[model samples]
Target: MWHVIIFFWLLYYLIKPKYSRRSLYPPGPLALPLIGNLLSVWLGLKKYKYHHKLWQSWSQTYGNILGLRLGSINVVVVSGKDMIKEISSREVFEGRPDGFLYTMRSFGKKLGIVFADGRSWMNTRRVALKYLRNFGYGTRSMELIITEECLELVKLRKTDAGQPILVNQMFNISVVNILWRVVAGRRYDLNDDRLKRLCALVMRLFRLVDMSGGIISFMPFLRHVIPGLIGFTEMKSIHSSLQAFIKETIDEHRASIDVKNPRDVIDAFLMEMSTNQENAFTEEELHVVCLDMLEAGMETVANTAVFMLLYLVRDEGVQRRVQKEIDDVIGKRQPSLGDRSRMAYTEAVILETLRLSSVAAMGVPHRALDDAHLGGYLIPKGTCLLMAIHDLHNGEFWEDAGTFKPERFLTKEGNIIQDERLMAFGLGRRRCIGEGLAKSELFMFLTHILQKFFIRIPDGDPPPSLKPVDGLTLSAKPFRVIFVER
Candidate 1:
């Protein structure tokens, strides 16, 4: 029958490359005929909270930079901070792949900032940064916006004090509101049903990317044949829902757009579209860009805050020290950005949290624009590159890297030291566009929460596992906390 013929054809097509073109690639496990190293790589990540475990184990035998064959594509993972930093900065390595899922998510084109490359990415990033600054990206106004939201978060927690509460979800409202204000010129109420749905959908989308090393991201073809098996159906539904929401927001901005008087990121983007007809900024692109920023901003900081709280919950001494630091520096009045420099311990806690739990453990997939040499290995153009940040952080970069010691980021003079090794937001042109805003928001939220409440494990329940759940972000499992009033 035709089915058997097609099966043989696919087998021959997949197996052909292993015999002929395997020599040019960097050394990895000898891939099997047709499937390559797909099964091993997939099975390797099936059991861990962080995918870096699998890569770190492989890097020992194959050097810091080694390639793996996933399906028909070749992927190179870079370990250790030095190699990750070098590979991440290369201009030739700045391009993104045209994989089915990558393109499909961005409306069948690399239209937005996250999955885009070349001139489109360049133009969009430049314009977005410029206008986002005008909208209070790194200024005191931004700090105030975040602080205001933090107050809402505190109020919400106070309402449910001493109850078994999912602190991460509560943090979600405040974090989303800050970005919502900056990007959309408005803030959703903490109890708004729309805000909750939007945040949940975005979180689910990222979690899908974490399962089985995000098999669907590169192997999107499986979705066509076996959507349920591959998680493509859920991903598509979430994307469609998010897209519709973004479209409505953009349409609202379009109707009320003023040339001289821009409101937020949406209006600013519209103004740019009005003038820059030649660039890649379009209505569809705007939706993706908004979603990109929203998706990046919402869960990352919240998850981090939860991680910090997990540490605080487990280590009461450190928790008391953080609170004491907050008390000495900022007192009872809302913690401001100005207090950050003096609160070295609090700053170190944030830095350490980022180091220990790198939310985006693997940097977004980077594709080679042309044949390139790295660590003596030739990476062919279109080869995918991954930054195993877990290995990078756990390597020789930090003394006692396995421990949760914030003092590593502190000096003898009690000042916070800035290490280039702490690359949670990444490096170079493709680094997180909202890093400035995110840092501001994160600092404010953590300080404000610690100032008002003591984060503790819930009563009459077994202590939940401290190991983070594997996802696009390394996050605490859904464990409840009792926020005892300070």
Candidate 2:
């Protein structure tokens, strides 16, 4: 009798529905036991190639707040602008997920700002922002550094002005060097082989991340079961190489120490670690923080710039209009941060690029710190919250949502309009810390390039495809452009 009862229990467990018909969670498709919605998500990814698109498709059936269970994890995808803002602003929903992929990046534990949560995350984020700001992040002083790098890029590209050159990774070195200056007190030459390798590693890192956090993130046992076949080895190798590089840089900073005069962000962090004993500011934390800076800053800014250029090249009329604006205000003069105000059309172009490209398609996943109600449904504690950012930008709020129209962000009076619906940098507490620096770089780099060159599609070549190569961030497909000197 005991054996029969045990057998029935086991069978029920294997075939049970993860979400019952009378569940309080938001309405969603049926989720199977153990696997839950993994198979459906996988199929969606195979069809759409982007998580935001997949979630948008489901939202059509289940309304804005769609719920699901991927293995043992409960996920709530919040679409619609108002609902996204609600979740983004709530304190109870600011936690980051502590899954295997997140911890694996920080040595088998959550340690950095991007993945860590609670008190430690709060402290690290506070310190990082304070120090990064002190080192000229989002400041006028940093504008000069970006200007210098923009000049270098302009000089390098001048050599191939008439020839078709691949522009996909063109902005990587300049963008990374700008952040490196703040983080490490140095910059890399555009041709540095080390910079090339580092950029490759960063690129590979983004590709490894699945829109649904990968199979290993949910089924972590796969690492132990089929480590070689399941990309575990490659992932580990990439992370180890990146950490080693950051460690080497930190060691050099330690050798040439200056406590009183903090040379850069690393110096500031080191000083904090030395003096503040209460926080979880360790050497490992420092390494991971620096890695976070590079990976986060490099991919977002570089790819967005490339995407901006891709759009401009495809639309010569738009390109000419922007150049006209650049010519009208600050023509042939170096573009300072102040110039950004008078250049409304140029600002609109940047805004349109961010809205259309939506590099961070899903943005970083947020976790529910406590069980809470959103969109008339219960989000249990430990549920992963995915803010459908791409959907928000392209959904009902905007007219001609799919078209690349900078004018959509502009008013009839020739002024830039600030639409709250465009949450490209995300919203609330976990909003990207590099937003200010990113905007500065985009304005300066784009203005400088447009002031000097006219980006054109090469003769006899087809127009570049607007379709993005999807991954962690939406990347522009490989294409070449001729930078004709104006």
Candidate 3:
């Protein structure tokens, strides 16, 4: 009789819902037994190439705070500008999800600013930001490096002038070079084979993983069963090679460290590790932080700049207006960061690109640290939180949010309007650390290109579709442009 009682108790415990639907938890689509909403999510993602859009579709039916279950994991997607801002500002929503795929990126554990949380994330972010700024991350000192890359890009494109030049991943190398210089005090040659391979690998890594962390994240055991079939082997290989590259760079820096005068971000981090008694700063942490820098620094800015060019090519009037602004303000004088302030319409174009592109669409998933109340729902601890940033940027709050209009970011007086709804880099403490540098790079690269060349679609080829190719970041479709000299 006791054995029968014990068996029934176990069954009941196992079969019960994690959170009561009849309770204060947010409403969502019905989740099936064992699988929860996994199949539904997969099918939705198939229809909508991007997961944020998938969430947006569901948000329409269930309202802003839509609850979901992916296997044993619970998810809450916060949409609308107000809900997004509420979650972003709250401390409980600042934690990073501890899923299996997240561990795969950083030596079988979470160890970077983008994916780590609590005191460790705090210390590493604070230190890295401090030293990165010191090494000309957002400062005027970076202008020379960016300007050199801008010129290099212009020179290369000039050779293919009036001809079709595919720009799908064209800006990757230039953007990576700038990031490498800041992180390790070195730059890659434009035609270097190693740089080309690195660029390809970075792009693939991002393409493989989506904002939802994929099936492996929820069902990690499946990797051992059918690794190659599900992309586990490839992702592991990519992470290994990328880590090796970062470790090699760190090894080179370690060999020639000048303690008093640090050369770059690596040197400063090493110095901090040696002196800081806090156990947070480790070599593993350093490796992961550099990896974060590579992905965050290279991917978003590069893709955004490319998307900006794609938009310019599609709309000649917008393109010519931007060029006119550039011509009016600088007049062929070597463009500098200072000119961004004076070029209102040009600045508006950049802002508009960020708004419309919405790359990093989900803006790095945040986890709920504790049981918290948000949007009048009971958010249980250990729930994965996703801010519907794409929705926030494109939803009804704006006037015709779907259209790409730089004038939306400008007032009647032609001054840039600072809208709280435009959260390209995100909001709150966990916001993108490299925002300043990204803005500077976009301003420098775009202005330099527009000033020297007229971006046009190759003759006889229809205009490139403005629809983004979905990935971890929203990428512009394959498109070519003729750099007709101005």
For residues 379-416, what per-residue lDDT tens digits would candidate 3 score against the true structure? 88988988888888887887888788999988899898
| Number of clashing residue pairs, candidate 3 | 0
All-Cα superposition RMSD per candidate: 5.0, 3.0, 2.4
TM-score of each: 0.92, 0.94, 0.95
Measured on C-alpha atoms, candidate 3 has an lDDT of 0.86
Off by over 4 Å in 1: 1-21, 46-50, 211-213, 396-399
Winning candidate number (lDDT): 2
lDDT of each: 0.80, 0.87, 0.86
**Ten-residue segment with the worst summed lDDT in candidate 1?**
209-218
Find the 10 residues in a row with the least total lDDT in model 3: 15-24
lDDT of 2 by residue, 1-486 (tens): 999999999988765653442277987878998998999988888998777778889989998889998888888888888888888899999999877888888887777788888988888899898998899887777888999999999999898888999998899999999999999999999989988888888887787765557777888898999987767888899888888889999999999978988899999888888888886489989988998988988999999999999999989889999899898999778878899899999999999999999988887889999878886688889888888888878877788888899999888999999998889988898898888889889998899999999999898888988888777788888899999998
Model 2 weakest 10-residue run by lDDT: 14-23
Tens digit of per-residue lDDT, candidate 1, span 342-372:
8899889888988887777786778899988
